[model samples]
Target: MIIKPRTRGFICTTAHPQGCAAQVRQQIDYVRKQPAIQGPRNALVIGASAGYGLAARIAAAFGASANTIGVYRPGERSGGRTASAGWYNSAAFETAAQEAGLKSFSLTGDAFTDETKARAVELIRKELGQVDLVIYSVATARRTNPRTGETSTSVLKPIGQSYTNKTVNFHDGEVSMVTLEPASEEEIQGTVDVMGGDDWQMWIDALREGGVLAPNATTISYSYIGPELTQAIYRQGSIGRAKDHLEATAKQLHEQLASGGGRAYVTVGKALVTQSSSAIPVVPLYISALYKVMKEKGIHEGCIEQMYRLFADRLYSPNANEVPVDEEGRIRIDDWEMREDVQREVAEIWGRIETSNIYELTDLEGYRREFFQLFGFETDDIDYEADVDPSVEVPNVSA
Candidate 1:
């Protein structure tokens, strides 16, 4: 079936399989071309189908030469519809790994569930023996707590007081003020429950109990602390409360793993045109401006570049033990994004950006293209009008 891009606000409901495969190949090619990393020999990436999670897996496998197992819940093709972009991504990744003679496996299920944990443990024990690196990068709007049997849905709203900000409809470059009411206590807690580090902690505990975690393992999770421009809707919002919990969990996990020389870290990344970021108010506009500045300055780093740097430069350098971090003890890969020059220029753009000059002043076009690229659309390598199979199988899906 020939597939084209289909979209609702901030989401592409349809994905092109061949295009996804091409994008995966491009990432793998990029990693292979760069200097090899002295990182993990075996890795497990929870939420390993898209975004930073997928990029981390590629870097570990292609750059660090690690065997990797990925865990994700992606939609399957049904009723003549295409599978989720993540599904095709995993399929493409597994195929590339096989070609490269790297051991790669995909496990599809809810990463929050006990059953998925058990399955992962079983897979690790049987295939990789132990994983020295574990990356927690799950992004979801809702989560069902295995311990409590209750579901929590996350909301993107500020805390304490309402927030009003200039936001853009990236589709048409319409700039307008968006006012969001503050989240209630229940809503704030719910967001924390869904996006917090509880699931990450549980995964670590299960891995340790199952003896699939290497004694000297290093585990990292992704987070974002944008500049003051997006602080209210992001870092100081309901999601921010959850991230605070996540950072706290990193500390606890560090203590818990310190006995065996393991480490836990939160790597704060730069804002990009990810599916999740596109959903947040004011972020897309901010990212559009940031992208223009960074691209012009030649300091732009995408997920693949960021993940490779995290492994080579910070996590496993010659002085790996002395990883540089902020006062909060978290790695700041957002260094370039938060540079004084970048933020100053972005602030300048924010002050006067409106519908009329948004296109001229920002990289909204680039932002839109990347957003489509996330769903395997608008890619340069594949013909969208050509017929392709939507039922592509991930070569190494867990039995």
Candidate 2:
């Protein structure tokens, strides 16, 4: 099959295997050229197929020389569709990890379930022995309670009143106004149940109980706190309420792990083009504007760059006795993204941005390129003209 990008709204329906592999390799190459990290020796990354989760896995294996196990729900091929970009990405990552003589493995299915958690613990015990670090990076629209079997589907909406904001169609650089209604309490609860830290806590409790966590171990889950422009739709929205639960869970788990001389933290990450972020109503426009400002200022950092720094700078800094955190005990890699000057400039553009000046005022082109790159498309190095296989497999994940 000669696979090309097929799109419907915010998702890409097809994935190019070689293009996805190349994307993984580019990030690996970038990590390889940098100084090695003083981080974890054994790691497990939940939702480790794409976006921030994938970057964290790459950083753990390549940057910190850690043996890693990844948990993810891979993309499926239905009729004419190709396997997801994450499937290709995992296959490529495993291929590289093995070629480089690093131990790597992956498991597929919902990371929100007990069966998945139990099986992951078993893999850790059987293969890697114990993990000193765990990165919980799963972001899903729905979750089923392992005990109750109840399903909760999350919604991205404001918590109170309606949220009206300027947005963009990065595909064609058309700016528009969107008004998202406030979520009901039920909707907010559902969002929290799906995206919150309950599952993260469950994973930690399972790992600790199964005795697969190394002594003095640490765990971190990814979170986001964008600028005030996005506060209504993001930080102060239903998802923000979920983040509140997630951050609170981090503190709760921190105490649980403390008995074993271990710890946990929530890392507030920067917003970029990701599957989850793209679905949010007003964030893409904000990210596009942010990209223009940050890139021009020469301080733009993607998932891989941010994860590498988290490990190298704060998480494993020799200058600190333990991982340093903010006043609320959360790690902040969103610093550059939340800088006052950056926000001020983005706001200036946000005020005057329209259809005509979108390209001039924002990085919508860059945003589109990165968005396509998420699905293994729009990469110059991959020949879209060539025949390709869509029935690709991740070589390391039999389970």
Candidate 3:
């Protein structure tokens, strides 16, 4: 099978196994080159098959020699159609872990369910005894409450007032202004329910109850705080409300972990092209501009670099340098990215941006390439025309 990207919007229906393997290998190579850092010996990564979650899993297994259990939603390959990038990513990670003599298992199911949590806990007890680090990185637009059997969807619109901003179709490099209506009260609440910290706290409570979290365990969840240009649509929007809930939940989780010397922290990361971010309006343009500046400044990093830094420098630094936390006790890497200087420069460039000069001011090309690379489409080493098996099985996939 020659797998390629089949996209509707912000999602690629087909994925390439070989290409995903290449991506995993590339991340491992990057980790190998970095200065050695000590990390958790046993770990569990929720949303562990794609984007930042996948990078965290790679870091744990390769950078720290940790035994890891990954939870993700797997896609089925049908009729010569390839699976989702996550499915292929899991396969690649499992293969790499085995080759490196590390224990790794991937569970395919909903991470929000009690049954799933029980299965994960059972696996941890039977295999690794307890997890020293838990990375909560699930990013989904919808989730069904297993307890009530009620399905809910999340909205990413702004609150209080409708927002209109310049956006780019990174796919085609088309720049345009987009106007998004404000989210309703119900929409805001639903978004909070889906993306907020409730599920994260639930996971922690379940793990604690099942004795799956080791003493002095540390848990981290990913967050984002972009520039003022995006504040209305992001940090101060519907999704922002959800992030607020998540940040607050981290404090509560910290209290819950106090008895065992464990702690929970939310690490706000820089904007990058991911499956989730592409769907948000105005973000593509902002990411494009940010990428240009960061690249020029030699500070551009992908998911792997960001996660590696988070673990090596912030989470597991030997010197115990206090991870820079905001007043809310959440780590704020994105704050550096959202500094007044950076935002002002970006805003200036944004105002001058037109279709003729957009490329000069933004990394639109880079964004498109990364987006395609997520589904294994625009990679260099893979022979896309070569015959391959779409039904390749992921090792240690719990049925």
TM-scores of all candidate predictions against the true structure: 0.99, 0.98, 0.97
List runs of model 2 lying over 4 Å from the truth. 76-78
lDDT by residue for model 1 over 4-104, one digit each (tens)?
88888888889998888888899999999998988899999999999999999999999999999999996779897899999999999999899989999
Q: Which ten residues in a row have the lowest lDDT in candidate 1?
A: 312-321
Q: Give residue 395's lDDT in candidate 2 (0 to 100).
A: 71
- The RMSD of every model to the true structure, in order and in angstroms, is 0.9, 1.0, 1.3
Question: Ten-residue segment with the worst summed lDDT in candidate 3?
Answer: 332-341
Report the lDDT tens digits of candidate 3 across residue range 183-288. 9999998898899998998898898899889979999998888877899999999999999999989999899888978889999999988999998999988998
Rate residue 126 of model 3 by lDDT.
91
Computed on alpha carbons, the lDDT of every model, listed in order, comes to: 0.93, 0.91, 0.87
Candidate 3 deviant stretches above 4 angstroms: none
Off by over 4 Å in 1: none
Compared with the true structure, the alpha-carbon lDDT of candidate 1 equals 0.93
**Candidate 2 on 1-399: residue-level lDDT in tens?**
999888998988888888899999999998998898888999999999999999999998999899999999957566888998999999999999999899899899889888899999999999999999999999889999988899999999998799898988888888899999999999999999999999999998899899999978989998888888888988899999999999999999889888879889999999989999999998999999999999999999998999899988888876788677889999999999889999999999999999999999999999999999998898877889999878876777946
Worst 10 residues of 2 by lDDT: 390-399
